[model samples]
Each structure stands twice: as C-alpha cells, then as structure tokens.
Target: MAAMYQVITPQKPAAILKGVGPKVAEKLSSIGIETVNDVLFHLPANYENLSVMNLADAENNDKVTVMGTVMTEPAVAYFRGGKNRLTVFMEIDGIYVKVTFFNQPYLKDKLIVGEEARLSGKYLKHKLEINGQRLIYEAGGGFRVTYPMGKVMHSKTFNKIVAEVFGGFSFNYDLPETVKAKYRLLSVREALRLIHFPKSPADIKEGRRTIKFYELFMFQLRLMEKRQKERVRNERYIIDYDIDELKAFIDTLPFGLTGDQKKCTNEICRDLKQNVSMHRLLQGDVGSGKTIVAGIAAYAVKTIGEQTAVMVPTEVLANQHYQSFTDTFEDRLTIAKLTGTTTRKEKMEIVSRLESGEIDLIVGTHALIEDDVLFNRLSLIITDEQHRFGVNQRKRLNDKAHRKNVLYMTATPIPRTLSITTFGDMDVSIIREMPKGRKPVETYWRRYDEVDEVMASIASEVRKGHSAYIVAPLIEESETLDLKNVQEIYHMFLDCFGEEQVELVHGRMKPAEKNEGMGRFERLEKPVLVSTTVIEVGINVPNATYMVIFNAERFGLSTLHQLRGRVGRSDMQSYCALISDPKTENAKQRIDIMTSTTDGFELSEQDLEMRGPGDYFGVRQSGLPEFKVADLAEDYRILEHARLSAIELSGEMREDA
Candidate 1:
C-alpha cells in the first residue's frame, strides 16, 4: 500500500515551503496537513462564485467576493470570554462595508485606511456586514475555492499553496487500463488537478465523478472477493427450522405482527433454514420492532438445540436486551448475559453453562468475542447496530469450526440501492411499518440562544408527568471546543431541577454508573437523564417523551437519528428539539433534514448526499477498504456502476487465477 503514494522521496514537510514557518506549520498540522502531499490533497469544502457583487442587489447571507477600499481605521471590539473582534469599515462602490474578524488582532495591519483589497465572506443586506472575512489576493474572477479552513489559514492561502504545488507538474497513474476503461476513469494526475483547482464547472463534475467511482469500486472489489471466498466454505450449521414451529412461535407473540415485520421475519427464517450459511442484513426504522424479528430468529435457532449469540455495542444495551430476551423466553428457553461488567463468578458460571449446553441463548457486548467464550452448538449470531463491530469481530463471536448463519441488524435505515451496493454480499430485509402502540417521534431545529424556549417546552411536558433527555457532545469541557459539555449542562439542570430529578451518563462513565443512571430514568426515580450519545442505541424508556440535543450539529445524521429514537417508544407523542445554530450551510441542511422527517432511511440518504466517506465510518467498519472521496449518498449512481464492474472483474480475476 506504501507504493500507492507517489510523493517524491524524502517527503518534504509543509514548513519547507516559501511562506510557511514554524507557527504556520503548527496551524497546518492541527488540521492533519504536515506533508506536501497533505497540502496537495486537502480538498476544497465547496466552490463559490466570488464575483464582485453590487451592494444594491446583494441579499442577506449571500456569499460574495468584493473589491473594496478601507474607509475607516480598524477598531478592536471586545466580547465575552476575552474574545477580541476587529472591525474595519470599507467602501465598495461607495456602499458601506462592515468587515469583522474574530480573535484576529493582527489582521488590523493587513487592511490600511485607503488601500483597495479583495475580501471574501458572507454578505448581509441589512447591516452591510461581511462575516468570516478573509483577505484575498487572487482574482480568479470566475470561481474561488473555499476550504474547510483552520486558524492562521484561509481558502486563499490554501489556493496559493495548492497552485504552487500543482503548477507545471502532474502525477503518474497506476490504475490498470481494463479497470480504467470499464469505469471511464480519468488519469490520477488529471483527477487530482481538476479536483483541487478546476478550470470549469464541468471539470469539477467530471473529476468528482471519476474519483468517486474509483473509491467505491475499490471498496466493492475487496468485499466481493472476500465474499466469493466465503461462499465456497462448507456450512457447519445445517439444522433446519420447522416451519410449523416458527409459525406457532410467531402466533404466540403478544400482539399481531405488522405485515412488513412478519415478512422480514419469514425472510430471515428462510435464510437460517438453508445449508449455506446465511449472511443477511436486517434494517428497520426506530420503533419498527427489529428486536422482535431478531428474537423470533434467535428463538427458532434455540429451539433446534443450538446456541444464539447476540452482540451489542454497549453494556447498557446488552443489559436491556438481556431483560427483553428473558422476558420473552422466560419459561420457553434458558437465557443468560455476559458483559465486561459481569462478576468473575457470574461470568465463569455463564461460560460453563454456555459450553455445557445449559444456556440456549446468550446476550452480550464485546465480551462475547473474547477467546474464553466458547459456544456448545453456536449455529446463529445476531449483531445489533452491526456497523459498530468490524466483520472479523462479528465472525469471531460465532463458532469458527462451523460457518454459522449470521444476521446483522441496524436501526439506521439506508436506501435499498445503497444497501445493495454496499452490502451486495448479503441479502436484506427492511421493516418500515411500526408495531402497534408505537408512535412517531417529532423533531425540530432551533438555535443555541433559544435554550429558554426549549426548556419551556420540556417543562410543559414534565408537568404532564413525562420525562426528558438532554444530550451534549462532550463529557467534560475542553478549552479548544466551545461546545456545551455534559458536566456543565448537568450542573445547570441540577441547579434548576435538583439532584433527585436529574442524573448524568456519558461514554466515559463506568458501566455500573451508567446502569445506575439509566435505571433511575427507566423507573421514574430521576425524570431526566443528562447524557451523551451513550443513549443513542437500544436504551428504552417509554416515559421519556422529550429529548433536547445541545450542539446537535456536532453529530452525524445517523447518530442524531439514533439519539432521537430514545424517545417516542410508546404511543404518546414525543418531541426532539435539536438545539443548534448551524454555522455552515451544510450544517444547517443536516439539521433541516432531521427536522423534516423521522424516517431513518430518508435522513441517511440526505446525509450521504451532504457528506463524504470520511464523515461516515465508511467501509472500514464494514470490513471493506475505506474510500478517500466517494459518498454513498451523492455517488449512488457511481456506486451502481462500481458494484457491477467489481463483480465482473472479480469473476474474471478468479477464473484467470
């Protein structure tokens, strides 16, 4: 893989460049750009037409690049927390221009009283203000590239560095002609050049499409090859499930199954009955009853005198599943749990029982994958929130002697096209309809300043005997991030509601502590749980009908969706207020989609379109190679082509070998 990089020998540090010094290098390093290649590959966030705008025609919040002359001396404006804002009055076409820079005291020297300069930022119609202002030197008259800049760096600076590196030079290509021809891919040099600094909109489109295809194709190729190899392995779990028995079990369910749920259950059952080990993905929306489908599948396997191992992401979820499974199979089948927090004696007893066939069903977290955990007749494995664990991790939890059937469940709904393209090796079952008594969660987007308004809504709900959840991005405050941390918010809430009513939980907390906090919220002892994304998956509290996510813009779409799912578990109406004033247009778009729909699949699709592979876990968590550029949502059409091409090439490679 080292050969994949074509950078010259003795890789030059970014500091070696003409204008970069130690201080500038440190700023670049903060954003993971230390090498020349890093600078070359740091792609633009988006392209904006920065043509000079007529002030009379300019609208509020319009991104613009205007040439203006300084009209007044720069002044330092003081804000809270010792933040110093520099303001300079300018005249563009004799119209007033108020440009402000936050914490950039040195910027006062850049703009003189009468010098003409080009400025780039968002323009406002009312105050004639420009926010996020960056002094620009390059005219680029047509379109300017805006980067995801850091302190001490701006899009103009990146443009300068990239232009220098890309000038009068080109990189070499390594893709095979057959593959390149199949995907209609451009040369590596051309793609990089155009991607970083395109000559036209068409170049951007073509370059992006070409790079996206390669990323997606590479991911698909490796997965397809491994899947082909797995297909030839002998199936060790061949015991057939009785159709009549499975039907009898389904009929015994407390409530009638939704048609979609029933159909998905049947599909999974059919896969298990097959001799070829089943590799299936089960997808459903929140409160769509995926757990019941898994329960039904696990029960049928247990009835056949085989063990079923269910792996979850966290201890909270593991315990939650343990209770639910036990309640469902109390007198029907023997069940047990093993987690990281399990006592030595208890773990040993469970291990002994599992190996001796005393336990028919076992639920656990990563503890299930430990070498000491040996199943007696492990025929089936069901993983909840499947993407949390890598492929080999899931495979390790099942019996290695036999190729056991595997069922992966995710409450994060993805488009069917994407599912087929990404998980092409496995069959899929989707459940969109909710079971009886389940209600849809309502969501909204609000600004951070509207905390009082959000709290008022929560108070209204609490007065009606309902509960709420307040989630933060961080557990403790970091000097670097201005985010609302759990500790700070916890204290604020405690001061308002008192200790008896509010408890805290986060990823950093001990398993016992988390369980204690969740227990209080579940039993109504503490009506509110101030937490982090630790409650994102599988923690059920039907009475908690309201969730307020502070700094909601920090989370990914799927994660945000999962957090919202914690509420609206019952028929009672639930509310989710996403407290955020998204600074970027993309951030605002993400929050808007969350407010628009409760459908997980729709939100996932929108997320894909709005973000790249790095924004998501990508193929790395799913046991496939990671993509450097492709977006599953934005490159859906490209993914289709890549999957088909990869399949064809995989067959050809295997036959040739």
Candidate 2:
C-alpha cells in the first residue's frame, strides 16, 4: 500500500552534496551539522543588503553598495607596521570616491581600470572614504545572508552549497495544511529557501516568523507528549504519616513557618499521599526557607518507614544539610552524611546501615548515587540547587528506587517563560514569603574609586561585633580578565585586618580547609572572610551583616542576589555593597538592578531579558530545549500560542483515534 522509501531523505549524510569533500563535511560536523536536514535548518544570523545605491543619496556611515567605474588603476601604498593599503579611485554617479582596502594588496591586480565594479562598505563622506570589504565583478545585486560560521567556511562558499542543496531537494511540511492556512505560514521548503536566500528584508522577516512558530510548536508538542507519558499510572509509595506527629515536629522548631512555606509543605504532602509518583519543582528566593519546607516533606516521608536521599551540588552544602536535618529531627530520625571526602570505613558502615534500613535519611553529594550505596526503601529524592546537576545525573539517582518521588529545589527564582518551557512536565510550588523579623538587606552600588568608603563601612560593621563577607569573581589572577581575585582581596583584607581576623576560602581548597575557614567566620572568631562565589549557596551566618562584592559587574543579577542573601539572615540591619567600575552598558545595568531591588524573581526576569534564556542559569544543561529560531524571552507570546495550539491539536487527534 505504501510507496518505496527514498534513500536520500533528510536524514541522509550531508556529504552527498556537491562541493562537500571529506574535509568540508568534517568541518560542518564540528558545528553540529551532520545531516541534510541540518544544512537546511542552518539559518542566517543576519542579512547584508547589497542593493546598489546612488552615491549622491547615500549618507555618511551608511552601509551602502555602490556601482562605480574605476577611473584609475589600483595602487599599493606601504604604511607603518609593515602594512599595505590598496587604493582605487572610482567614479560613481559623476562623483569621485576613494576606496581603500587595508592589508589587501592582492586586490590591486583584480580591480582593473575603466571597469565597472560593485563595492559594499561603510561610506564616510567627510574624508570621502569607502572602507570596502566586498568587491564584486559580477552583475547581480541583492541581499547577502550571513551565518554563524566561526572559521567553518567562507560566506560565499557556504551560500553556494546551501543553494545547491536547496535546488536539489524537497521537504515535507510538519504542520497540517489547515493549521498552516489558518496561521498564514509558508511551507517548509519555501520558508527554508527564503531564510537562506531572501530578496529583501521583508522576505527574511516573514520566513523567520514561520520558522519561529514551527520551532516553538514542535517543542511544545514534544513537551506535552512527555507530560502525558509521565502522567501514566505507576506503582509508588503512598506516604501516610500522623498529622499530630508532623505538627509536634514543627512546633519544636525555633521559628514559626511562613504562610508560603506551610502552603508548599501541604502541597508536597498531598502529592506524597497519593499512590502516583510525585515530580515537582520547589522554587524559592534565597532565604525563603525552601530547606525547611523540603525538610518537613522528608520528615513526613520518613515516618512511613521510608528513606529520603537529599543530594546537593557541593560537599559543603551536603554537610550543612546533614547538620541541619540532624538538629531538626534530633534522635527522631537517623541521618547519615556521605561525600567524596568521607572515610572508607565510615562510608562502608553508612552503606551497610542504609541497606539494612537503619539510616532513615542520607544527605550527600553525587556519592549518594554510587553503585554500592544501596537503599532499603528510598521514596523521596530531593536535589538542592537542581540547576547544577545534569539530566543524566538526576536520572541515575532517580533510578536508584522504583517510581520514587522527585522534589527539585532551586534558590534561583526561574522566570515564568523558562518555568513553563523547561519544567513543563512537573508541578511547581513557590515560596515567596520570608520568615517574620527578617529585615531587608540594604544594597548599594559603589565604584572602584570609592573603595576607601566601602572599606570604612565594613570596618565599622566589624567593630560592632558583626562579621563581613568579601567576595571576588575569580579565585586566582587571570591574564585575560583584570577583575579582582580572591588571593588579592585576601591580602588586601589582611593588610587592613590582622591575619587572625581574616580567613580566606575558595573552591580549590580541601573540604576540611574550607570548612575550617567558614567555621572560624561563623564562630565570629574571624571578623572578616574573603572568598569566591562558592559561598553563594550555603553557610548561613546570622551575625554576618556586611557583604562586599568586588567586581560585582562580572556576575549576573541573580548571582548578586544570592550573594547578598548570605547576609540579611538575622534581624540586624544588614548591608550589601556592590563594588565595580563597569566597562559595558549591560554590566552597568546588571549592577544597577542589583542595587535597585531585592526581589529575586524580578531580577531573574530582568536577567532573562538581558542575557537571554540560554545563558540564564545555564538552562541548556538544565533540560531546556535548544531552540533554533524561537527566543524564550522575546517570543513568549508566540510560545503561549504554540502551547495552546499543541494542546488543542493533540486533543483532537486523541478524539479522532
């Protein structure tokens, strides 16, 4: 009933194309272009207008393509620094213009006298200079598409290859005809053609719109499919714990839970009560008490004779969580900590206790997912700072138990668009309310020239029996970047304060050394601590009222917020000073946003807009779809439309089936 399949489908190797030798194919493969469809989907980054313009109508600094007759032969003029410039005089629309090409002496023989040529470049009328890069001896002129080819191939050569493939193949459209007609979108073949070789700017715009919609629509469809699969019924642990017991445990805490924390805890408990597996994301701003909420959930799970695994990105955080949980549950639950630095005998004993169900809960780093570390009854898996782990790493941990619940926690408040596109398969719980008696951190932006004033303020705070955290961008000196490093700042602080008063911490240090430095600072024995961004996550010192970040412009707004959250944990009036002399507008804006608002969600939205979704928290590794045409920040409306369309279409297909 079906026709024979063709051998040269879109999935065929791209080396079959003309002018594509083994070397060219290898080069293409380096940039992730390995198939015929890949070559088709490699859209242009921008379009260069090569349409000829009259010299009289062109303005200064305008990128114009002008057709002119060469009045004199091109001559090579030697310049300083062993450089040579090829200058050619041309007559365009009865006006004389000088075209110069620097370090391109070979052009003198190609640009002959009295021959009409087309030159595309910036026109400077004051000096009558046309700094030209493109010189065409041909007749046709239109728009030249520019791609993101980083030394992969020349634009002209790539364009010709794309044209050959375009002319030789046909594409099958993914969208149904009815949907395409309703949306007024071009077919796949036409859209790809126009995107690669457009006649005008409008053609490029139309083609890009169609491609963006297609990319988003397909992505949403895949997400919806995955969601449906995840929703299928599975045998899972039904956690039923005593209400009075959880309440009594909560009562023993030092502080009352906020409304948001209680709400999230209730939501998580409700999910655990069901037999179905739980997959939820717990999003909260820094210092919003996510740890306590997760702790409560884990405590509830443990009541049913089930074990919980709390995994963190760093060993320091693992140790912190282990200590916090042990203190909170004190003799009510048996908790063990495992990390790379754990002694072999200790790890073996912990593993034996875990296998025998003696350990009610275990807090560790990636060591939790080891092969020999088997669990008796693992029900809930909590990953703190979920963005730092890859999808495969999470999956390996999830595979430890059959149909276990996963509660991913992040201190970075993700934007709404990213939350939908990236975590669409999971339900989300947000905790936005801070605990009572917590004061907002007073934020200030200071330039490098104001270092004296900043230091004076920090000194004053330390003199008041409070500690200070000084953060730098780099751990050591970098030849390329001139930003401040931890060692430099450590020495500077040592000069201001004696060696006994200052402690330095960085990632390269051993866990014992880092913990020692942090312990000294936490104990208030060291009034000042100099460190890198490793301190951005854990280590809560309520008495540390001052946070001074050097070269704050090097970090994102969300990072700055997290760093500032290190302080402001207590009722004391805390202050965060951002120190930098930014060289770019974007960097300046990031610093300004940090000083303007303490809301992590608002800063995340601003960050998404400024740095885009891919760079926002490294979403690419966080299970975000790598979109070719659709931008999560700019095309949110289109994303919404595409999502709705996918839902409707899938429902229709289900009914039809």
lDDT of 2 by residue, 66-163 (tens): 98989898989897899998888999888899998888898777787888888888899888879987786656766877888888898778888888
Best of the candidates, lDDT: 2
lDDT of 1: 0.79
Instruction: Output the worst ten-in-a-row residue range by lDDT, candidate 2.
Output: 1-10
TM-score of every candidate relative to the true structure: 0.68, 0.88
In model 1, pairs of residues that clash are: none
Q: Global lDDT for candidate 2?
A: 0.86
Q: Which regions of candidate 1 are displaced past 4 Å? A: 1-222, 233-236, 399-403, 415-422, 618-620, 624-633, 644-657
RMSD of 1: 8.7
Error of 1 at 569 (Å): 0.7
